[model samples]
Target: MREPRIGIFGGTFNPVHIGHVRAAIEVAEALGLAGVEFAPAARPPHKSGDPLLDFALRLDLCRAAVSGIPGFSVNPLENERPGPSYTCDLLADLARTRPGEQFCFIMGMGDLLCLAAWKNGLGLGRLAHLAVHARQGQELEAFGRFLDHNAKAMGAAPTADPAVWSLPQGRLMQYVPVARLDVSASDIRRRWQEGKRIDGLMRPSVLDKLLTHADALPAGWGRPPAA
Candidate 1:
């Protein structure tokens, strides 16, 4: 039997935005994934000093964002797990619970560029294939070179195609092009703080929840008075 393919999309998701939902939808359709799991991180190891909203609220927002979306679900694995969240650890947990399943770790081009700096970065390929979303202004040639370097390091044969690269332990990495959206969670927050319109940037449910509790936002989230 063919192993079920599941896409693991992990992020802070301080507030799930339309950009996020759109990317996941596009990637899942492009890869023919069985399902896409939006895993919200309780505490990201790489980010610091930025006050994240409560984890429960973030999880609720994630659930709301994916509501009524077919083949999409939210996973609170990272939120329930102790300590800072790491991709490798999440993959390990999934491997244990969902044996004989294939996982594709979905990420953006920027994260791919910095993968080597991640915890147990080299082992990432062994855990799951990488489904990287292409970003604007990024050189494909440079990306190919980086993948070739990593493949060689893993004792895998290099390929002429940059879109797909084979890795040791039968892992594969593929670049997936998705619709570009100028939306981001931080931008949404900033807009809300400035009392500017953010109607279409986020899902209606999430935007409504945030607006309903604007006063409860974390410290430093409000806009400063005009000079």
Candidate 2:
């Protein structure tokens, strides 16, 4: 029997919101993943500045968001080590610690495009599969062609499966289609600052944590100018 495949979805969950949760669900179903692990970044090399919540609090929100959700949980592995938390290192660590299981690093099309710039980025396929999910405002066919072009450049042979691209590094890059939501973390934060109703934007449990620690959020994310 094939080993169980797990989806490793890492991100700066400034505060885990609905879109993040829902997308993970859809991606899990699409890829037949056993579960999705949400790993919050301790210090994202790409991200720098305020309004990014403290690591502990962001970790708390991630825990709340996935609490009691079947086949969904949080992984604090990124915070386990010092310095910038790179996906390559995360996947390698998981591979080393958890044997007999296949891991697919879940990311969006944008991340895939930027993968080459990441630390040990090109070698990610050697560690595990790359699952690139859909995003809004990007042409699917164009992106598919782009992936094909990239795969060719890497000297990876083509497969009959259109959704799966086999990398020469002996792993795969999969394109997963997921439902797109109009919501985002920035919008959610903005609404909160404006005292807008954010009832359906996330789980009640997550909202509870957000409200309790809201004062810790950067003031720049607070209140908008009067119209």
Candidate 3:
């Protein structure tokens, strides 16, 4: 029997939207995972796009978003650990703490493409498996080329299945395909700020909490200040 495995999905979850939740669901289903832990970043190294809410609030939103969802839970490990949260570090810690369970670090193909730039990216397989998901219209060929070029670098070889690659530390990197959910946190925040209906973009519970704290949102989200 295969060793029981769980998945770790790390992100700002800047108010975990439906897209984020749905993608995680797809990856979990595809990989037959025991559960997926949504770990919100306490301090991100990048993100010049938009200002974020307090880590506490973001963590609250993530918990609220996944609340009552089967096989999904929030992990606050990043919050406990000071300094910028990196994937390799998080997975390494998980590997140390959870000796009996295997872990799959979940991420998007875009992130996979930028792995080399991430802190300790290449060494991730030593820590845990990587389940990278991609949306339609993405360049799978590029990913294929990436797998081909890095096969030696990762000390991995192709399996009978083209999409799965072996990694040095008894880990695997597989490409998962998920439906294109045209939803994004930036778009959701912009909609909320623009005074538009964002009813269906996220879980209703999440919307409720966001509205409950609507006044707390940054003005830069596009909401004009009161005159």
After superposition on all C-alphas, the RMSD of every candidate to the true structure, in Å, is 2.3, 2.7, 2.0
User: Candidate 2 — which residues are off by over 4 angstroms?
Assistant: 135-138, 152-155, 168-170, 219-227
Candidate 3 Cα errors over 4 Å, as ranges: 136-138, 219-227
* Model 1 local distance difference test score: 0.81
Q: By descending lDDT, how would the candidates be arranged?
A: 3, 1, 2
lDDT value for model 3:
0.83
Tens-digit per-residue lDDT, 134-210, candidate 2:
86445567556766666544545556877777875466777777777777887887886776778888899989997
Better of 2 and 3 by lDDT: 3
lDDT of 1 at 9: 92
Model 2 TM-score on a 0 to 1 scale:
0.88
TM-score per candidate: 0.90, 0.88, 0.92
- Model 2, residue 103: displacement in angstroms? 0.6
Q: Whose lDDT is higher: candidate 1's or candidate 2's?
A: 1
lDDT of 1 by residue, 5-90 (tens): 89999999878899889999888998889999999988888876686787778888898899999989999899777998999999
